[model samples]
Target chain A: MESDQYYLMRTLKVDLGERSYPIFIGQGLLDQGLMAPYIKGKQVLIVTNETIAPLYLERLISSLPNSLTVDHVVLPDGEQYKNIDQINTIFDALLEKRHNRTTTLVALGGGVIGDMTGFAAACYQRGVDFIQVPTTLLSQVDSSVGGKTGVNHPKGKNMIGAFHQPQCVVIDTDVLNTLAERELSAGMAEVIKYGLIYDEAFLCYLEDHIDGLMGLQPDLLEQAIYRSCEVKAEVVAQDEREAGIRAWLNLGHTFGHAIEAEQGYGAWLHGEAVGAGTMMAADLSCRLGWISESDVKRVESILAAANLPIYPPEQMTSVQFKEHMAVDKKVLDGSIRLVLLKEIGKATVTADFPVELFEQTLSAGDKLGKFI
Target chain B: MESDQYYLMRTLKVDLGERSYPIFIGQGLLDQGLMAPYIKGKQVLIVTNETIAPLYLERLISSLPNSLTVDHVVLPDGEQYKNIDQINTIFDALLEKRHNRTTTLVALGGGVIGDMTGFAAACYQRGVDFIQVPTTLLSQVDSSVGGKTGVNHPKGKNMIGAFHQPQCVVIDTDVLNTLAERELSAGMAEVIKYGLIYDEAFLCYLEDHIDGLMGLQPDLLEQAIYRSCEVKAEVVAQDEREAGIRAWLNLGHTFGHAIEAEQGYGAWLHGEAVGAGTMMAADLSCRLGWISESDVKRVESILAAANLPIYPPEQMTSVQFKEHMAVDKKVLDGSIRLVLLKEIGKATVTADFPVELFEQTLSAGDKLGKFI
Candidate 1:
């Protein structure tokens, strides 16, 4: 890939009437003076974690206009730190520096940073403007588009949050060059999800190029990120509040959240758990006769090709999954709603699947990918 | 007032387009099965503080339909307890009880409970339905009409919050009979505010019926609550986000929040501080040549009639007031914008006011009520 081709920028709009915003995708877009247009105020507070601060915080800050008053809060890294206490730290910094209602918050790291900063923006002075600068593959492909911002409770993942959209999303694909190989595979789980749930053609494209995508080929990565965001932006525009089709986007999240909560929040990466949980949903879908064994195997292959987990943790029991899944945001009354495949590229959220099949899938563990 | 007259219920709508909801004000509305229609789900969580639980919790629980599952979390009573920890307690109860997205949270206490419950409902599962069963006069007339909800941050009053509207507001005027003398007086401060900011006719009504309203006369109290909510609903409908005229609703809050934060929350009831803050605002407006000495005296007379303070805490200094006012939500850039009177019934939010007048008002202290 030529260096000049890497600079080609792709922008997509998540249309939600007055709340609509653009997602800018390219290499080195962070330093190209693209964020100034989206920032609504003179004061900007960049919220990043410890790891990303040393790498990209300075680059992001120096790129802004000197006339803007820019400050930042460095949070402790990891999913474990994404709680109310850490969120309060961001609020504390904003108040201490006396950032007024017109101040804008810039999220400068991965999904955890984005989630916390977005939530802080949602609540600070009863909502303020925030821009998402996602640094990781998982965030770039998934969290960057949807306005779902929140912190996890000890009992549930994203149990506390709000539907607050960003002023804009800036995806600098170059940052993924520094991402760990495991983290890259984690993001690919969501990348493959777009194909499995909404677009068979995209799934086929991912299948044909999964190797190059995982290898961090800039063109393939950009294509994957842009396509993923496009699918997400479309779905979000249709259901900004998750009152309808938006639940389809949570194809693996209910099961994934159960894994995260049962094992403790940081035990597995969010995308890793989703990778395994997608296989669980596929298994149940096959058991419900909505999809064939071959389709389940295809789901397993794509996840495996990205070096992602295909099963829950060894110590996790069926009862633990049931307990954690009971509190999922998708649950209504006492019924657990699972987002399952009707076929590759088609998904539905339903509470109508038989109980025994769900129990069997929960007990399947390592045998989940098998065609029994 | 005839016994039959007390049975008449008045309902008003807070029109925020799709987010609009009704405020139902009556003597015995809480036990009359009015909230059943507004609750969206079969699960209900009644969030009330300790002081109110024993008084009204059972009555509220029994008032709901038998088919619905009901749970209640009693929080410790007071402004000091209004923080993230208490909010987390509400979250813990909801999660422990396995409340789902379809569940409705009923705020069954005063402004503190209403704010915290509405905030919890706003964030729980990214948003859920809630009914505000405001048991205090202040909440019924003020918070019930506006969607503003949040807990207080130590650095500032109501520093952490969201603008999540309720499903409905059920005001049971009968509950005021159980309210303490000081509490009733606190509620009066807000009632007086409505007359001061938007309606001279109402201010004249308040001045004429001041003793009867403070005495909790059913006819006078009901009229005051209904008219207060009416004015608030109109203002909120015009500007739901406080971007424009809605800031006028906070006529004395800029200075009141300073008094509340400086003296420590719960020291002075929100309305008492507002009483004094209104005096301070009137003083500043007078010094700015917007109102007369007699107008300021009229403000003092009404506040004193309601048994509210007309001056800041004796220990509070000008520096403390300035420090606290600097963080008020109305502050833009580096300027402190205040909602002040242009006349007895008209109010305006401005940052362009003369600095000397503001300084003089802050330093006035006890002398604020006695104009030169």
Candidate 2:
């Protein structure tokens, strides 16, 4: 692994008709001059949290000129803090500083900080400009590239939010070294998903070079992040506000949020919980005979090799899980619609699932931790 | 006049792909069985102030079925209450009640209450479904239909907010009959704005029947309310949020807010100040040769007949007025955009007004009243 490397940057264009923006991905994006021209004014709020604050806040803040009157609100780190209360802290600090409508909020952390700050900026003074500076692997791979910003509630994750785009995104791979081993493995769960949902060949890439991805290999890491963001960007660009097909992006989120909410936030890192939920979904798909048992085994093996959680912990009963799934943002009119495996490279969302199979899958996840 | 008459029963259909909602008007829209479907099973927060609570709170509460759980928070009424401290009241009430992402907020009152409630709902849990139960005519015609929710700061009015759409709107026009003459007249200023901006025929109607509108003539009132809502609905449907062209609806707001924020809020009613501001805008438009002097005169006579203030009170100097305008939400890249007149039935936004003319208008308005 080389310390200094060149990476290709791609742009995620959120198609809001006239109100579109480019989510630029590349190394050294922060040090570029593109930000100031797009940014409308002097005031900016670089919203990060305790975990990522000490590491990247100073470097990013310094990258901005003195003319850019910048300040930051370091929120309590993690998915647990991605709610209205923490979002309010950003609003409070902004108001105290008299940062008006022209003020832009720069998100400088993972999905939690990006979602929370983007939401804060989206609703602050009706709406303001926001720039994404995603640091963590899960965010860079998927969450940070799209124009989606929101907060979690005790009841569910990302239940409340708006479809707000960032002026630009600055994703630097250097930050991934600070990520823990569990976090890295957890991120692979989603990396595996793009391949499962859209590209089988990409799935082969992860399977062949799992070690390089896990060992902070910069070139491999850049390729993974760039491709994942490209897929997400294309999907979101076609549907910015999740009206019709955009809901497909919630491939594992419906089950994932239920596990996280039921277990209490931060009990399982979002990626880990999602990793488990995705496997459970695969198993459920197998039970329904939508995908062959061989496909389910392949997904389980790949995730297991990466050390990702492939099942729910014990005590996550099927009944409570079903009820939680009903409250998912993607769930409409009391019935839950879910993304199910059709093949290794394709998935579909349906409210038309067999009751017994759905129940069986939830209970299967309930026994997962015990088996682990 | 018919005994079964309702003044505010109109709808705004915004065509922003899928983020569109209908704004319902008419007296007793809540009790008319229209809101139940939208509000069903969702946790609801009814945000009202001390002044509006005793007046309409119980009526709204009883209107909802037992299927829904309801919580209420009341703040003191006035523009001073529109800030982060006041905004946190909604957050505190939400977290305390364990309301989550699926919760719905009902903003029950005048412009101040409606704006604050909508802004609160916009930021609460990062965004939620909020219904504008606008009790004031000003809000019914202007604020409620547009999905513009936000609060005021010491520096400006509506300086922060998001364009969050309501699940539904429940307007009870009968509530206006109980309103004080002053309040009703204050609201009439906004009512008159629609006529001035896009509907000169409506302006002519107001000119001919000022007394009928004032006396609460049901047939005439319903027509006025519906037509105002019709124009607003069309504008908002075309431009859900003020990105490029939707801002034409903010004809008098820029100047109006400067007056309201600078005068310490309680000093002037929102409608009264806006009423005067519209006249100032007309005068400015004429001075900048955007419209003729006769058009300015036509604007004044209509407002004067309705007993709305036709002149900016001479308390603030040109410098003071400019200082207040500096923080306006509509200002972008240091230039302020003004919705000026082309003729009686047309208007255009221009940021290229002559500085001397802007100063002259304040001086012109100063001789009429001692603002400074």
Clashes of each: 0, 19
Q: How do the residues B118-146 of candidate 1 rate in per-residue lDDT, one tens digit apiece? A: 99999998999999999888888887778
**Docking quality tier of model 2:** acceptable
Model 2: DockQ vs. true structure? 0.36
- Write down the DockQ of candidate 1: 0.85
Off by over 4 Å in 1: A1-6, A366-372, B1-6, B366-370
Task: Tell me the deviation in Å of residue B81 in model 2.
Answer: 4.9
How much is the lDDT of residue B312 in candidate 1? 88
lDDT measured at residue A172 in model 2 versus the true structure, 0 to 100: 74
i-RMSD per candidate, Å = 0.7, 4.5
